[model samples]
Target: MLKKEAHYQEHHFLSSDYSKLMKDPQIDDAWQSDIDSLSPYLERLTMREQRWLIGHAIHDQPPHNIAAKYGVSTETVKGWRKNAIKKLRNM
Candidate 1:
C-alpha cells in the first residue's frame, strides 16, 4: 500500500504543471524578461557555478543527478547552488 501510494503521488506530481511554459513556443517569451533581469547577476557567477545552475535550475535536474553526472557528491552540487545564490545576493 505504501508503494502504491508513493507511485501515485509521484505520477501526480510529474504529470502536473511540468513544462507548462516551454511546451508551447508561444509562451516561451514569458520568461524572457525575468531572464534578462537575472542575466547580469548570472554573469557574475563562476563558470562552474553557472554550469551547475544551468543543470539544477534551468534544466530542473536534481543535485544528486547532476552530482552523478559530474562524478561529484550531491552536497558539492548543493554547495555550488548555495554559494552562487549568496554571491548574487551580495551583489
Candidate 2:
C-alpha cells in the first residue's frame, strides 16, 4: 500500500503551470464554469489535500508557503498536492 501510494504520487502529478490558469484575478463567466467543474472533484479530496491543492494550484502559492501554513515540510505539501491530483484522476 505504501509503495503504491508513493508510485501514484510520483507518477500522477501535473505541472504547477496547469493550475496557473485559475490564479488570474479576473472573474469571468468561463472562470465560474471552470470552478463549477472543479468543485466536485476538489470536494472528494481530504481537507488537507484540498487546502494544499487550492493553495498551491488555484492560488499559485509556493510549496514552502503552504507547508509553513500547515506546519509540515515542503515535500509533504508537494505530496499532498500530487496525491490529491491522483485521487481526482482515479475518480
Candidate 3:
C-alpha cells in the first residue's frame, strides 16, 4: 500500500556502501569531502524539512509517521519534501 520508493532501507547512512566507507581509517579525507559537499544543502533545509529528511532517510520512517508526528497528513509531508528538494536544487 506504500506509494513511496522501494529503496528506503538502502538509503540510510549506515547502508553497506557508506558503512564500508566509514570503516576505512584512511578515508578521513573522503569523509570530509562528503561533509563539505552536503553541509550547505542540508543547512538550506528548514528545520521541519530537516527532521522529515532525517526521519525518512536515517530512521527509515514513512510519510504517514512523520505526518502524524506533526499533526498533519501524508500529503503535507510529501509537500514539505518537494519544497525541501526544490530549495536544495535551486541552491
The candidate scoring highest on TM-score is 2
Ranking by TM-score: 2, 1, 3
User: Each candidate's lDDT (Cα)?
Assistant: 0.62, 0.68, 0.61
User: Candidate 3 lDDT, tens digit per residue, 43-66?
Assistant: 656555655665576457899998
Ranking by lDDT: 2, 1, 3
Which candidate number maximizes lDDT? 2
TM-score of each: 0.54, 0.56, 0.52
- lDDT winner between candidates 1 and 3: 1
How many clashes (backbone atoms < 3 Å, residues ≥3 apart in a chain or on different chains) does model 3 have?
A: 0
Q: Roughly what TM-score does model 3 have, to 2 decimal places?
A: 0.52
Off by over 4 Å in 1: 1-38
lDDT of 1 by residue, 1-91 (tens): 7999966653342322333322434324655565455556656665446546656655578999878877999998888888888887898
